[model samples]
Target: MERTERFCRIEMLIRSRGCVSFADLMTELGVSRATLKRDLDHLRTRMDAAIVYDRDRNGYRFAVTGRQARRPGPPEASGVWFSEREIHALLTMHQLLDGLGVGSSMGRHLQPVLERLQGMLGTSDSEARELVRRLRVVPPARKPVRGRSFERLAGAVLERRRLRLTIEADDGSGERDRIISPLRMIHDGGIWLLDAWCHESEALCRIPVPQVRAVQTLELRAREVPMRVIEAELDAMPALRAA
Candidate 1:
């Protein structure tokens, strides 16, 4: 089993059985003596898990509870513990969200999740913050989009609702309104494109999200299109071609 799985299993076994023998842990984890020992040490030192060997029972159990409840020990870690590899994965997620423009628009909504993961890491908050600060992601030049428009359009697509869009004419002729059924929102080459079925043209069209001057969600239900057809339309779009 994977290291993370083993860690979880070890905790579960200890919690369920009150105490678990070294041999039992090895058997349950399908690991060698040395590996089990390393895992226990990592749980104690790195994860701040208050696990202690019970000499009387000849087994291991949580120091915070069980028969030794009265005995004083180090405080148990408050939240879930993440392995080193998991910490790296969380850092990658943080960077990706910033790159995708979600941080500025949706940061407040997602801050709690981020904080929970950050707190669960096996490092101090300052260290985690320092690591995130050191690894900078410089995204390519991206077109600016109004957060409200993006949010409303995204909701309309998920809700299967139609939209009334005021799109800026390509030739500087001004804006025109089009009623469209949004199919999907595609982000490619630092631009957001709305894939929708145009009611006026009776065809699938890709609209640059930044070029949308105004947006309004309609009460009417959106028309559905097959996934294969959407893929074909996306393949033919000029924005998706090789630059």
Candidate 2:
């Protein structure tokens, strides 16, 4: 990757991970320690972002509230706002969920905002209801997992890093620390699966999120695994295929 791309990625990683160590950044970006350190210095000094070390965690993170402060704010209304088509699509999705009788916490939060958006567009409540009633989404049956861990796992995958997790089976007989390079998250058979590369097995694995006892991000970086190859491998897995 180019230096510029590396720098941009480092910045995004810091934002996503809340704080990253020189070693972690180097591993993730496939750059030298010196280069990663320089990038960190640039962010701290030039960008006026507070990046600090945590003794307990032995990692770098934002000084303010660590990872919590990195959460994105609400979208601003000005400049290249969502088009009418996009708004309609969003409403349609919400309606489909309503039809499925699946109440989402996110949807609950978005309801008021969606209503306000419709009002701004001068769309009547009956019309919005009708649109939602017409739209349908056949969501696969998947057991709900802890939302927070799912979010963290997503961050790890996007940053191309490894994760250390304790997985427990449904019968409550299995628990082990797994080092996985997460590729994507999928909901199937009413459970969320973290499609990943199991470092111990040196092969692809799909771990149920609900069965995950605890999650810890690893310092080891993820190798570039093609999505198509991962999908093909996943398709061949009897467990995944059945699910």
Best by TM-score: 1
**Model 1 Cα lDDT, one tens digit per residue, 179-205:** 999999877788787889999888888
lDDT of 2 by residue, 1-243 (tens): 654455457656766776567678879999787777776675555444466777887787656554545657421111122446666777777765443333453555667667655543444678767766667676656566664566678679899998888887656776778788888887656666788888788888888777777889888898668999988888567775211
Give candidate 2 regions above 4 Å deviation: 1-77, 94-120, 123-140, 240-243
Error of 1 at 101 (Å): 2.8
Model-by-model lDDT, in order? 0.77, 0.66
Candidate 1 displacement at residue 18 in angstroms: 11
Candidate 2 lDDT (Cα, 0 to 1): 0.66
